[model samples]
Target: MRGRLLALLIAIELPIGCVTVLTAATAYRTIMGDIEASQVQTTDDFAVRMRVWYRGALRSLLSFGATVSEAALPPELCGQAGLKMLDRARGFSAVLVRSADGRLCSAALDPGIDAQVLERTAASMRASPPVAPWKGVDLGAARYGQASIGDRRYLAVHAQNPAATGQDMQEALLLVAPAVLESVLDLGRGSKGMDIALVAPDGGIVANRGDTPPEAWLPRESRPPAELDRWHAADREGTERTYAARTIAEPGFYVIATFNDPHERDALIQLAVFLLAPLATLSLLCLVYLRAIDRHCVRWLRSIETAARSRSSSKRARAAMADDMPSDIRSVAEAFNAMVDEQEVRQRRLQTALDDNRFLVRELHHRVKNSLQVVQSYIGLSKRDYQDEARTALADAECRVHVLSAAYRFTLADGEMQPVRVDLFLEDVVSMIANLIRRRDQWISSRIETAATLSVDRIIPLGFLVADVASRVLRSTPGARITLSVVDLDEATIEVALEADREVAHQEPPRLFAGLLAQIEAVQSGPAEGRSLGRWRVRHHG
Candidate 1:
């Protein structure tokens, strides 16, 4: 609450720094568009090489098949011709011809031919025959045949031709070695942060750029992004990363160009540029603005706060703030001064009220004394002209009047606004009643048992009730001692009972009944232990 001016300055300047930092970070990704463009161009070059490699294998095999069949070579002579073909095959691993029933007959290679791998590749090409390319290295009548077996990497190129017997067509598979695949990938790439992989259609990685495995760019559990764009996947180490994957050389085999995430490096670069940007200027501007606020605005507000908190009754702190200030802040100071002036005016009015109350008290005391004398005169006249019942009624009336007068005088004397003590009020009522006993033999005594206070609104009614009941007992049975039991019923209520012996005053109060005084909630007619004639329950009021 006290730092509102400082907070306002913070609210203004903080957003500028935040928006600048965020926009700069977003601009970093916009810069990544260039790196992504580099990767796309690299993959285009790699895909062209993949096409040459796939189609070149077929052209060489077709040449071998025609050379063997044109010489009327039998199944046994096919090995001699394939051996001659292998010498000029470049990176070819093995060239094998299989009989249509699928067992191998002739083979030529550096090591023994993998007849089973060739048979499997032939079967795979039969099941999922590939569509041929529309352009670039379309070898005539060459069907796609590639496979990844165990740790061996190769592309199987198959061609079918007659054995010169013309009974059935024989299948020949030419396997391109790993080195040949590497040369195809090594052809060209004009990009950074990119690695190339020749993945078989069955998702086996055959040849790649380095040992960092294609698994490092993309995890096994994740599918690549649908477009040539960024995706989130974890590496082999289970650390999260971001990369881009684009498929080249499609359909027959996937030339998936995988890129390592270079975002951390990019971010470092961006941070350096951001530090050199207008960010320092923004910070300096904020500092300057905050200092200006503290100098011009906050200084005046704090001085106004000091003036408001001053303890002097004379209100001399109004000049603490200088007159020269901003128009808005000056209005606040003026409001503070106006509130102080109002408070001072209220103080003088309260003092005047206190003086009036003192004069009122003096006049009240004189009137109460005269009223008691008039009550005494009425009692004298009732004794001479009336019977015993009427005289007793006048005496009860006189005691009730006295109780009210004493409560009023006690409440008004030197009082501001405070609750009247029940014990003190009852003591005064009881003392007045004791003085009322005229006969030498008749006497009144009391024991007040509780100490509580109530507002004057409740105290006056309570005093009237106590005096009314006590007067009944004293008048009905002369010389009967009175015990005023003032006990707490609960936290919110108090009970008063006049316990006496040999009194015919068990009837309910006629003048001041329970409902007549809203403060006294109820009346008890019967004595619990055969002593009290009447008991009144008074609820405490604020």
Candidate 2:
């Protein structure tokens, strides 16, 4: 019993368990997806701020370079102009003017100038056209490059004056203050295990901060493309991280930030709780339901079944057991006992009514049979000594009486009250009419075509109509064959058609049958000429 109970509980819990697991899985995916999106958004916002800071510095330097070129000052006075420009620029560490022929014309360095950087800057300017500082441009006009000045690293921006049409091809090189790039990288440094880097066009690390080296954290090939803006990857430690990258307006340089995601571990814990909590709750509910059913329902049902089988003759035994049962079950037991008592009373009353109905039916059949015979006898007496036409009319009256007698006999043929078959009833009427007027010299043939059945009340009147019309047809044209047809037009209506071999003159129905014709919804007659065949059609109302 314990095994069976456990199996039942497992059967009920299995589907719910599956659903709980699926729900937990789906919830985990959703939570992780949201966390990923939030991380990407945070990184993207940081990238935007970095791009703004870099572009502003590039624009300021480009404007200052154009101003110096337009001044067209000689190499001797250019150094004084550079010092004045540095004083006005907030984040410029140094400003230098180099000529097209590899000569450093002017210099302004806060931490003092480096001779090697000046040579390299002059060399790079001669080799490549100036790369544009704005985004979406190929690296051709305005350029950004990294320079090692003494032991310290510096980022350089080189701009040329293509609009300067005279004298020498003069260009300006500005050394950006390291603090500017450091400030942008500092944004993500507050978070634990977070790293930030500025990458150059040739995959060189321009500036970076945090425990991991920028190159080891993100290889050049693994960097997110410019269009994607952000991506996810795992580092050397195999811990998954999200990375966001944005192209700096100055040529091929990009800003990228990486951080470890804390949501993944938290989501795992939430998913475990989500999967197990419902199962534990459901298991408890199942145990409670089993205990309740065994105590309140199963034992009471067994007792009821056992008492029923015992067949106790006393009502007290059944009542005492029923009173001891639960209120809900006790009410059911009372209703059952009450229904049995009422059914017994109904059976006795039904038997008495059956006996009465049998006697009434027999009496009705006897009286109807005797009355029809009396009327038939009266017609026989009245027809005596009459002429042929008068006798024929009396014979028709006797035939109608005989039809009513046959209808009563058929009604009684079936045990009690029953619907009469219209087709069979009409067939009998047609056969009787055919036999009544039938003679050796002049044979009167009849045919019935129908698949309809009606009750005795409806069939009797219908029979009268058919017999009256058939009788007239026989008298009007001797040796004529007649057809009686019934068709069900629909569920609630029927059509009856009578046709004869010869032309049937149109005559209004007798006063007795006028009411019956009114009961019919429609009547149509076709003459026996050309396409209008001789036929009488009657449509019964629904």
Candidate 3:
């Protein structure tokens, strides 16, 4: 039983472990996926804001340049007009109008323009003819560029207008301050350890703001992904980060943001702990339960087995089962003890019955022997007297006694006080009587047609009746043949008939014969044709 229980535990525990593992794995994947999606959404939001602001700045620069280029005013008046425009334009640091031949036509600056910055701008235009190869901007029309002068980066926008016929076109240059780009990239306000930057088409950092240095804002070897707006990758220092970028409209620059994902590993650890803690606790509980069973239940069962093997008295065995048994198994022990007690009671009853049967058998043997001996002595005494009538009566008495003795012996053979087969008993009695008469010329035949049984006391009188009737027929009709039959008339009665070959002397039955019939509650009905045939009907009083 313990082995079966252990197998059951294994079956249950294995499936529970499998289900726990599957649920934990699914939960971990689902939670991590949510975290990654949330991070990407945050990065995309920052990119969207930056894109909107950068496009607005470019549109402002274009409008300012277009206004200055189409003006038909005097050079000094144009310079004055450009200065007024600069005051209205928050992004532009300076506005300049130049001739097609690299000559400065008009200029406006908040802080007075430097000579070196002007010379450098002129030289760069001369070196690259129709469109300058600017450091930041990638437009072939030379419409936009990023220039550095005296450690200050400027976003330059140029626009040209042709004269009426065949003349040099008037050109306008709008120099945007670095602070305008700084404001566009400064949208990383919500999340910590995030860097937002505007990356030029040529892969240079135009402006950047974040927790890290400008060089570290974007990895050196990394290129913007073309397909996805947001992704994760390792930086030049092998630190993992999530990145998102959006293209700025007019200038075709990228607004990229990188965020350090602190929750990824921490969330994974939390998920593992959340999933495994219960399983570990369950395993511990199982172990504790097994130990408890071994301490209480298993030990109790072992004690029961020992008591069973001891084969002591029932009371001792019941005591052993009850002692030191756990409360949970107490009912089982009680039932077992009850069964043992009932068995013990049955065993005692059976032993007492056997003793009574043995005693009865001994007494029955003594009585039967004494009775047979007394009959034998009477026959001996009658033999010594030699009177024919007395001898005949004594011989008949002896024959009746012998028949009674045979009935007792036959019934007692089975070692029980039970009824004797009446038919079989009568058959044996008739045979014995015929042999005792010993007449060569006479033949006696008996038929027992009854299927009934009677007790020893009941059969005794019936035996006497059978023997007396047989003797009278033999005397009255010498050299005659007789047939005797016993038949069951009903459930409660039997009939005995005797038939002779010749008619006997018609005489009333003797007093002793009448008394024997009365003792058995029998009635004589026949003796038709001068007693040649007779029948006696007996009702079973028992």
Tell me the TM-score of model 1.
Answer: 0.48
| Per-residue lDDT of candidate 3, residues 43-156 (tens digit) | 566556654554454455445544544554556776677677777777767766554444444554745564346556644533433433333553234344566766677876
Regions of model 2 farther than 4 Å from truth: 1-26, 98-105, 110-116, 125-140, 161-164, 167-170, 188-190, 210-216, 219-221, 224-226, 229-232, 237-239, 249-252, 287-542
Runs of candidate 1 with Cα error greater than 4 angstroms are: 1-271, 274-276, 305-320, 365-398, 412-418, 438-443, 455-457, 478-481, 503-508, 511-516, 519-531
Answer with 1 or 2, whichever has the higher TM-score: 1
Per-residue lDDT tens digits for candidate 2, residues 189-209, read 346666777777766777777
Top-lDDT candidate index: 3
Clashing pairs in 2: 130-140, 130-141, 130-142, 131-141, 131-142, 132-142
Q: Which candidate, 2 or 3, would have the higher lDDT against the true structure?
A: 3
| Candidate 1: C-alpha lDDT | 0.64
Question: Each candidate's lDDT (Cα)?
Answer: 0.64, 0.66, 0.67
Cα lDDT for residue 381, candidate 2: 88
Question: What would the C-alpha RMSD of candidate 2 be, to one decimal place?
Answer: 15.0
